[model samples]
Target: PLGMESGAIPDDSITASSYWAIDHESYRGRLNGVGGVGAWAARTNNFDQWLQVFLGMVNHVTGTIIQGRHHHNDQWVTSYKLQYSIDGISWKTYTGNNGSEKVFPGNNDRSTPVTNLLVNHIDARYVRFLPQSWHNWMSMRVEILGCTMNSKFLLKA
Candidate 1:
């Protein structure tokens, strides 16, 4: 399943701080991968704003791709924290100096998206994208990687 089409978005999937509106809709589908040019936008410029997606089921997440909003101009995420939660209540941050709250650097080139390869697998059902800094505005087209829980179970070696 590519995008959010395969996974399920629970009612709690969209608890962001705020949203930005324009010719485009500030919908979550923008992150669903179905939208080749679709994207999700945050209203506030503050770092507290975030977007979280539920994978419907647990998965062994390995990596991710973050595509900036490039309808005409560039809207890229500069710095952010990637977090995962198994139960959706408690969360753990990835990519940081302390190794707890990891801050991942975004794409410097607007024309292309950035791929982040994790050193280890994250087993969780919810993945959250929290923007700490950005170039233009906080907007993104996202792709989650790795396999389903069943695959994790069957492929146990």
Candidate 2:
């Protein structure tokens, strides 16, 4: 479901990706799941016509960066964590359960608006985020900030 309505996903002007094929190596370590209730994802997969529907949920305007450049960010999603992997099948490549280190301009507890989340140096094939909690926040135009580190390849390819 990706917590979004069908009307939300603007399949507008997307004409070049349906037939474009990616290299096998470019698809490594990509299918890893982030932190979330597996049951919820399962329900989404089952009822939502498989997870393929959610592929590329966000519109990439800049070099396929996969940013969720929304109107404003006021979602309850808090405490994001990041992890890495190399082999694609196993997540052996890991650092400390990094939050602030992986994220720039701060650590956890970002209760205020951070002007910039300086995160351009990160180059990984797999990355995951676990929204620990959310505050009293809800909006129609909330954004997910950057896309998964795994999504960067969409641009490079």
Candidate 3:
């Protein structure tokens, strides 16, 4: 795991388009964060809302694990799309083997985590989860699944 729950990924690396409030802040969007409201909630519930993470360096991202707002079954992301970037400027959406954009299914409830593995691994330093559909409102906690690229491989890429 890239460590949203384990804190291997620092708080500075986690961010979102907008947060509901301090308690529902972006940094709290880590799997099983402080407990209640242990997820990031957007200021507005819409398709445009997003939660992002900076991996610090390029990693072979294989999948993602997601959950909804803690203890609140009504508030959770139902579906989302992933976009990745190497420099945080130019981005490319994760696609299927046929090259169409992929929409990953999100949680059905608040606590049970949902996992989505990529068909092709993405080598990127940044990954953003853009909500496509949600339950009550846009809210989620997430963790990236992958390993850091070897230093030599990173330099070559």
Q: Pick the candidate with the highest TM-score.
A: 3
In TM-score terms, candidate 3 sits at 0.92
What's the CA error at residue 157 for candidate 1, in Å?
9.9
Worst 10 residues of 1 by lDDT: 23-32
Question: Where does candidate 1 stray beyond 4 Å?
Answer: 5-15, 22-37, 95-98, 152-157
- TM-score winner between candidates 1 and 3: 3
Top-lDDT structure, candidate number = 3
The list of candidate 2 runs beyond 4 A from truth reads 1-74, 92-122, 136-157
> Once model 2 is optimally superposed onto the true structure by TM-score, how far is the C-alpha of residue 91 displaced, in angstroms?
2.7
lDDT of 3 by residue, 13-116 (tens): 99999998778888989987755477899999877788999999899999999998885446889999999999999999999998899999998888889999
Per-candidate Cα RMSD to the true structure, in Å, reads: 3.6, 14.0, 3.4
In model 3, which runs have C-alpha deviations exceeding 4 angstroms?
A: 151-157
Model 3 lDDT on a 0 to 1 scale? 0.90
- C-alpha lDDT of residue 100 in model 1: 71
Better of 1 and 3 by lDDT: 3
lDDT of each candidate versus the true structure: 0.68, 0.24, 0.90
**What TM-score does each of the candidates earn?**
0.77, 0.28, 0.92
lDDT of 2 by residue, 1-157 (tens): 2212223333231111111122111111111211121011111111111111122423221111111112223222233333333433343222334533433221122132322233332333333332223332211111223334334454553
Clashing pairs in 1: 95-102, 95-103, 96-102
